[model samples]
Target: MRINSLPLRVRLTLLMAMILSIACFSLMAALIYTARIVYVAPQLVPKVSTSEEMGREPLPVTIPSVPPIPSAPPIPSVPPVLIEQQINFASTGFLCVILIIASGSVLTYRVAGGALKPVTDLSKEIEEIDENNLYRQVQVPPSKDEVSRLSISFNRMIRKLEKSFTAHKHFTANAAHELKTPIAAMLARIEVVQLGGPPSLEEYKEALQDTQCNAERLNILVHDLLRMNADLNVAACVTFSAKELFQSILSELAAEVQSKDIDIEVHLEDIPVYGERNLLHRAFSNILHNAIKYNKPNGSIQITGTRHPDTTRITIADTGIGIPEDQTDKIFEPFYCVDKSRSRELGGNGLGLSITKAVIDKHSGSIQVQSAMGMGTTFEVQLPNASTVY
Candidate 1:
C-alpha cells in the first residue's frame, strides 16, 4: 500500500523510523570510513647503508666495519585480527540500527495512537447522535487542548442545530393547523349546503360566500408564509421616503380608518431610508391595518417619523385594545394571536406581525412594541438611514 494511505499511527511510526535510520546509517558510515583511514601502521624511513653494503668503493676514511644497523623492519601489514575486529564493529553498528528502528517504530505507533484516542472517541460520540438525540452532547476533555476545543465547538453547533430544527418543526405544525382550520370550515359549509337537499338561492349564496371567505383566509395565510421565506434581493434595494410609504398605506386603509371614526394624525418628517419598497410597504401596511381593525370608534391613531444620524425611526400609536403584558412577547410568533376569536373575526390569520418582523430583520432594522391592556399600543421601527445603507 502507498505510505500515505496507511493509518495515521502507522504513517507516523514509519516516518520516525525512517528519519532515525537515516541519521544512524550516516553516522555509522562516517565512523567506519574514518577508522579505515586512521587504523593503518606508521610508515618507516629507510636507513643509510654502509659502503660495502652498497658494493661501491670503500669510504674515504676506511672506517672499521661496524655492525650495520638493521633497517627498520618493513612496514607491518595490517593484522588479520584488526581487520576482523573492524568488520565486527561495522556489523554491530548495523545490527544496532536495525534494533533501534524496530523498537522505535513500535513505540512511535503506540504514542501516536494514544494521541489520537480522543479524536476516535469523539467520532464515536458524534456518530451516536441523530435527530431524535440532538440534545446529546459529546463528552468534553478536561485538558485545554485542541480535542477539548473541538468537542466544545461541536456541542455548540449541535445546540444551534437543535434550536433551528425545533423552530422549523414548530413552524410546520402551526402552518398545518392554520391551513386545516380554513379547509375544514369550507368543507363543512359545502357539505351542509349539499346535504340540506335542494337549497334556496339565498342559502346557496350564503354558503358560497362563507366558502369564499374561508378561501380568502387560506390565500392570505399562504401568501404570508411565502413572503416570510422569500429571499430579499439586496441588489434591488433603493432609497425611499418613509413618509411617503406610510402615506400610501394610510390611503389604502382610509376607508377602514373613516369607518371606525378614528381620528388620525401624521407628523412624519421626510426621512429617507434604504430597503425594498414593496416589502416595507407591506410591513407598515400590516401595522396600520391592525391599528384600524382593533381601534374603538372615535379612537385616535398617531403616526410619526424622525431622522437620526445613522437610522430613521417611525412610531405608530393607536388607541386600540392593547395586548396583554404576558402575550406581548408572543405576538410575533406565527399563527399566534392574543385574541384568536377577535383576530379571526377581523379576517386576520395572525401572521401580519410575523411577516412585518421578518421584513424588518431582512433590512437590518429593529422593531419594538409597547402596550398596556385597554390603554393603547405603540410600534416603533428603526431602519438604517440612506447614508448608512451600504
Candidate 2:
C-alpha cells in the first residue's frame, strides 16, 4: 500500500527514523573530514629548510650522538610509495564509512517497515468498513502494548456505531409504516366517492364525511411531524400562569368533554411556569385529550396543579384504560401506540405523546406516567419554578 495510507503513528515513526539515520551519517562524514584535515595531512607533509646556507651545504652543526646531546632526531624521509599508501588507506576508510552508512540506512528502513506492518493493516481494515459491515475487528497483537489498547477502543466505537445505525433504521421504518396507513385510507375513500354509483344522498354524504375525517387525521399527523422537527432554539420562553393555561385548555375542549361524559375537576394553585406558551398548550391539550378519549363512560377527570419551593407539578389523572408496565417508556416514541387497532378506531395519529415530549424538553421539564394495566393512568408534569431561574 501507499505510504500515505499508513497509520499516523507508523508514518511518523518511519519519517523520524529516516531523518535520524541521515543526520548520523552526515555527522560521521563530517568527523572523518575534520580528522583528515587537522591531523593526517599535517603529519604526512614534508618540512623544507629556509636558510640559504642550508641550501648550499650541510652545515657541520655539533649534532651530538645519543649521549652527547638531547636534541630532536632527524626527521625520516617520506617515500613517494608511503605517501601513496597513506592516501590509499585514507581513501579506503572513507569508502568503508560510506558503505556502512548506506547499509545501515537500508537496514533501518526495513526494520521500521516491519515494526509498523500491523498498524498499516489495521488502517486498511478500518477504511474498508461501512455501515452495513461494522462487525469487523482489528487483530491486535499479543504484546499488550499501546496498539492493543487502540484496538480495543476501535472495537467499542464500531459497536456503538452499529447500534446507532440500527436504531435509525428502525425509527425510519416505523415512521413510514405509520404514515402509510392513513394516506392509503384517504386515497381509497376518495376513489370510492369518484366512482359513480346509484347510492342515496345520505350514503354519499356519509362517504364524504369519512373521507374528510381521514384527511383530517392525515393533516394532524403531518403537523405533529413538522412540530417535532422545529428548531429548539426558536422555542422561546414566556412566563404563563399554569392554572390559567389549564383552565383555558379545558374550556376549549368543553364540547369533547361533554360528549365523552367525563366530569372535569380542576384543583388549581397559583403556580407560574416559564416556557413557550403555544408549545406548552399543545402538550397540555394532548395529555387532557388523551385522558378524555381513554376514560370510561362518566369517568371523572381530575386536573391538579401545585407549587413546591423549587418546582411546579401538574397532574392529570383519568380513570381510563391504563397503559401496560412494559409500554410506558415506548409510549413517548413517535408512531407508537399501546393498542394499535383501538388507537386507529379512536382517530389518534399516535404523535401526541411524541410532540409532548419535544415540548417538555424545550421547557427543560420532565413528564412521568404512573399506570397499572387495570387501574388507571396519571400523567405528572413538573416544571422548575420561575423564581429559581438564574
Candidate 3:
C-alpha cells in the first residue's frame, strides 16, 4: 500500500522497527569483523622468533640433515582469501535478514493501518459533534464488525440529542410567546396612563397598582426562567431545621391564606436538612401559595413532613381544582399555565412550580404530583438524608 495511506501509528511502528533492525545488522557485522581481525587472524598467522640468533643460515648443510620436522602440518593451510570470502558471505546473510525484517515490518504496519483507518475516522467524526449540531451522521462501511456496532450506537446517540435539542427549542419559543403578551399589555397600560389626561386619585392608584403587579409578575417569571436554566451556583450545605423553615414560610403567606379563606394545617417533623434555607423556603412558599390560590373557597390545605430512617418526606395536598392528567407532567415547565385566563386573574406568571422544581432538584430531592381533574392535587417531596455519607 501507499505510504500516505498508512495510519500514523502503524507508520511510526514500522519506521521504528526498520531502524532497530538496521542497527542490529550493523552491530552484528562490526562484531564479526572484529572477531576475525583480533582472534582468528592471530591464530592463523605463523609466529617468528624475536630473540637474537645467528645472522645467516648455513647454506646446504646436507651432512646429517635430518628431515625437517613438518612444523605442525603447516598450520592447516586456511587461505586468507577464503577467510575473506566467508566473512563477506556471513555479512551478506546478515544484511539479507535485516532487509527481510524491515520489509515485513513495513508491510505489517501498512496492513494494520488500512484495517483501522475507519475506526480512527469514526472517532474523529464523533468528537466533532456538539450541542449545536446533532444532525451529523457517521457513514459506516457495509461490514458485520465492531465498527458497525459503533456506528449504530453513534446514530442512536445523535437521535437522542436531536430530540433533546428540539424539545429545548420548543420550550424557549413557547416561553417567549407566553411572556410577550403580558409584557406588551403592561407597556400599553403604562403608555395610556401617561399620555392620556391626568386621572383622579383613585384612578391613578389603580393604574399604579396594575403596573406594579405586572412588573412583579414579570420579575417572577424572569427569575423562574433563570432557575429553570439550572445555571445557579448557590451553595446548599448549610444546616437548617426543616420545621422552622416551613413555619417561616407559612407565616409569610398568612395574609394570602386568610384572604382566600383557606385553612392552613402544618405538621412539621423535627428534621434537620442540609440546604440553602432561603431557597428551600421559597420552594415551599411557592407550593403553598399555589395550593391556596387554586383551591375552592373555604378549602383546606394540609402541609406535613415526616422523617424516616434515611429520608425526609414532605406532602402538600390542597382541595383545589386538580391538574389534568395529560398536563400534569408539564405543569412544572416554565411559563406553563393550566388555565391561562384564570392565571392572569390570579396575578400569576405561571413560574412558581418551575422555580420550585428547580430548587428541589438542586437539593438532590425529587418532587412528584398526584392529581385528578376537579379532585384536587397532592405534591410529594422526598429528600435523602444528608446525615449519612454515601
Candidate 4:
C-alpha cells in the first residue's frame, strides 16, 4: 500500500520504527567489532618478545642431549573456546537488536496515538454538528496549540452562519406577509364585486379602482424586493455629480413639495462621486421621499453637500415627525415601518430604506440617520469621491 494511504498514526510509527531499527543495527555492528578487537584479534596475533628478554635468555639455558620426538598435530590458529565465544556474542547482539526494535516500535505507536487523540476527538465533534445543531460548539482542547485555534475558528464561523440563517428566516417570513396583504385585499374586493351581481357602473368603477391600487402596490413591493436582492453590475457604474442628482430628484418631487409648501434650501458643492448613477439616484431619492412624506406642512427641508479629501458627504434634514429612538436602528429592515398605519396611508411598503441601504452598500458607501422624538430627522450619506478613487 502507498505510504500516504496509511493512517497518520501508522505513518508516524513506521517512521520512528525505521529510525530506531537503523540505530539498533548500527550499535550491534559496533559492539561486535569491539568484541573482535578485544578478544578474537588478540588470540589470532602472536605476541613479540622484548629485546632485553631475548638478550638475557641465552646465558641461563644449558643444552641437554635427548632423543628426537615427533611434533604433535598442528595446533589450530583460533582456539575452540574463543570461536564459540565469538559465535555466542554475534547471536546475542542480533537478539538484542531485534528486542530493542520491537519494543521501540510499540512505544512509538502508542506515542503517535496519544499525540493525535485531540485531532480525532475534534473531527468526531464536528461530524455531529449539522444545520439543526449549528448552535452546538465543539469542545476546545485546553492545550493551547493548533487544535485549539482550529476549534475557536470553527466556533466563530458557526456563530456567523447561525446569525445569517436566522436573519434569512425572518426576511422570508416578512416578504411573504407583505406580499399576502396586497393579494388578500385585491382578492377580497374582487370577491365582493363578484358576489354583488348586476352591479351599477359606479360600483364597478369603484371596485376596479380599488383592485388596481392594490395591484400597483403589489407591483411596487415586488420590484423593491427584487432590487434589494439584485446583484449590481459594476461595468455599468460611472461617476456623476451629486448636486445635479439631488436637483433632479427635487424637481421630480416638485408637486409634493409645492402642495406641502415645504421650503427647500439647497447649498451644495458639486461633489463628484464614483458609483452606478441610477442606483445612487434611487438611494438618495428614497431618503428625500421619506422626508417629504413625513414632514409637517410648511416644514423646511435643507439639503447640503460637502466634499472631503477622499469622500463626499450629503445630508438631507427635514422637519418631520421624528422616528422613535428605539426603532431607528431597525428602520432599514425589510418590511419594517416605524408607523405602520401612516406608512400604509403614504402608500409605502417599508422597503424603500431597505433598498436604499442595499444600493449604498453596493457602492461601498454608508448611510446613517439621526433623529429625536417630535424633532426633525437627518440622513447622512458618504460615498467615495471620483477624483480620489480613480
Which stretches of model 4 miss by more than 4 angstroms? 1-6, 11-105, 386-390
Error of 1 at 215 (Å): 1.3
Predicted structure 3, TM vs. truth: 0.66
Supply the TM-score for candidate 2: 0.62
Per-residue CA lDDT of model 1 for 256-344, tens digit only, reads 98898999898877778689999999999999999889888999999888888999899999999999998888898888888889887
Q: Per-residue CA lDDT of candidate 4, range 205-315, in tens? A: 998999898888888888888888888788877878778888999999999999899998988776777788888888889999999999999898999988888888889
lDDT of 1 at 298: 96
Off by over 4 Å in 3: 1-93, 120-134, 139-175, 190-202, 225-236, 255-267, 295-311, 318-321, 324-328, 370-376, 384-390
Q: Which residue pairs come into collision in candidate 4?
A: none
For residue 168, what is the lDDT in candidate 1?
79
In order, the Cα lDDT scores of the candidates are 0.88, 0.80, 0.80, 0.88
The alpha-carbon root-mean-square deviation between model 4 and the true structure, to one decimal in Å, is 8.3
Which residue runs of candidate 2 sit more than 4 Å off their true CA positions? Answer: 1-7, 10-125, 134-167, 193-204, 233-235, 259-268, 298-311, 384-390
lDDT of 4 at 76: 39
Error of 3 at 118 (Å): 2.8
Provide the global lDDT of candidate 1 against the true structure: 0.88
lDDT of 3 by residue, 128-213 (tens): 98766669988876998999888988888878988787778877887787678668878888788889788778878887888787
Candidate order by TM-score, decreasing, is: 4, 1, 3, 2
C-alpha TM-score for every candidate: 0.72, 0.62, 0.66, 0.74
**Candidate 1 wrongly placed segments (more than 4 Å):** 1-5, 18-98, 130-134, 256-270, 290-330, 339-342, 364-390
- Local error of candidate 1 at residue 269 (angstroms): 3.0
**Candidate with better TM-score, 2 vs 3:** 3
